[model samples]
Target chain A: GESVGLHLPTLSVQEGDNSIINCAYSNSASDYFIWYKQESGKGPQFIIDIRSNMDKRQGQRVTVLLNKTVKHLSLQIAATQPGDSAVYFCAEVISGSARQLTFGSGTQLTVLP
Target chain B: SQTIHQWPATLVQPVGSPLSLECTVEGTSNPNLYWYRQAAGRGLQLLFYSVGIGQISSEVPQNLSASRPQDRQFILSSKKLLLSDSGFYLCAWWSDEVYTFGSGTRLTVV
Candidate 1:
């Protein structure tokens, strides 16, 4: 009963440009959301997270925006670098007696110099 | 200050063979452990999770099974490998807001 998807499968951006990766979740009851970045041949790493009550949260050079009304979550990276080239995934934490996290199809971000 | 270790970075096993992947965590106690499988170009699918030692919750029913023998150890196994079981397996630990992951194991059941 949980589905999360991305608008695009891959995004190509030039170096130093700002990159925005979008995600749409179907579950509105999710209490928290997190964005993860996965590099080739490695496990995913946490980039940022946002609670359902808040609309936006900022970390070093990245930001997470949550729109509960539309069940949309987005990750914005400033000054995209070559090192930032990776697959990004958004996960929504369904809260209750059991903690279930639903992950969306990742968007592969390719930074071109 | 928590870290996870997953071994056998890559394995090529034949069908009908037994499978075992190990994951261990350090610097934390009683952390939540998870086993995830990722097929090519697909999102992570949660296979099993353990809240504590001997407390395992399975999300999906398949050829695989998980075990938590110790507080910081989680293992995923199967009696006989299947071709469908070949994929990238990831081990993770969650505490507080952040979830840290191990280097992952790539299993190829041929």
Candidate 2:
């Protein structure tokens, strides 16, 4: 039963502060990972993605870090804002199976004023 | 700009009722289509995927089935709905190593 999981179910961060969310995946064959943000009653929006060959990838105000040694992944949002409050998910694509992505349970991020 | 459309944004159906959810992709052709379900406080679960027309792969054994009648059209159906089937259903298409999801359908089986 290979799966991806998050370390925290919920997170609270002060506005303008940096926020970090962590995830752990059990599949060693995973070659690609993605981070998504989903607001209430909306579809998950792609934030950023990283390949197994690279350890980190950065996007606008966001960064994704991958640790193959420990099968850990993290998403960092700089200058967290009220609009950044949403449920974040981490998904993994296994090698040779690019059509499907195994998703993590997701972490609810709440930005506080 | 490729976009995915899923219809019946919100649906309320009684148990044992028939169900049909349609999804279509625009601005793209022969793209990989997928159906995923997200329960309250849960992650996305892959229900079905189609790489091409008339080709479907089921990820989970459930009371649901999918069909790809056209290159850009994917449909999810069930002869009789169940209470456990209630959730947020999402349709997605793969492009450039990323998945673009539709707004999603909130199905509430009473």
Candidate 3:
């Protein structure tokens, strides 16, 4: 089965520091990817997305970088805050597959004050 | 603006009880709808999806099923639930290459 997985299950960072989360996907046919943030007891919220055609995309204080060669994806958050503490997931979608997304196991991010 | 709505924010049922979870999309028509299940601290698993009314595609075979009765309404149902059925259920609508998920329903089958 094709799977998207995160390298780390947990991360801890200072409030003012940056945070980096990594994901590896097994589906080479995946053309679109998205990063989502999920708070406790809430649905996952879309944070950012990037198509395979682009290597990097930036949004607000977050950036998504994709490496097709290694089938790797990463999300970077700057100036992490308490509100930024949550589980993050990376999802991949194969183009023309009815836009069905395969999600990775989330990484718990704890921002220390 | 489009939004997805799922009902019964939380539910508790005994094993063998029936189940029905409803989801609807507002401000959008003829959109793709999906149902996903997530266990505690785990990734989402695609259960079913519908492209249009009366059209459904099941990604995995399970004890559950889904239906699209209207253009914007999707429903998930099970005749008899098992303890394994307990989890967080999410409904989503796809548009403009993005998926918007509902708040989700927390189901506990004891």
Candidate 1 Cα errors over 4 Å, as ranges: none
**How well is each residue in A18-98 modelled by candidate 3, as lDDT tens digits?**
999999999998999999999988999999999999999999999999999999999999999999999999999877858
Docking class of 2: medium
The CAPRI quality class of candidate 3 comes to high
- Candidate 3: tens digits of C-alpha lDDT, residues B7-90: 999999999999999999898778889999999989999999998999999998889999999999999999999999999999
User: How should the candidates be ordered by DockQ, best one leading?
Assistant: 3, 2, 1
For A1-113, candidate 1 gives per-residue lDDT tens digits of: 77889999999999999999999999877898989999988888889989999999999999999988888999999999999999999998777644567899899999999
Say which prediction, candidate 1 or candidate 2, comes out ahead on DockQ.
Answer: 2
Tell me how each candidate scores on DockQ against the true complex: 0.65, 0.74, 0.84
* lDDT tens per residue, model 2, A8-83: 9999999999999999999998888999999999999999999999999999999999999999999999999999
CA lDDT for candidate 3:
0.94
Enumerate residue pairs that collide in model 1: none
- Residue B45, model 1: lDDT of 93
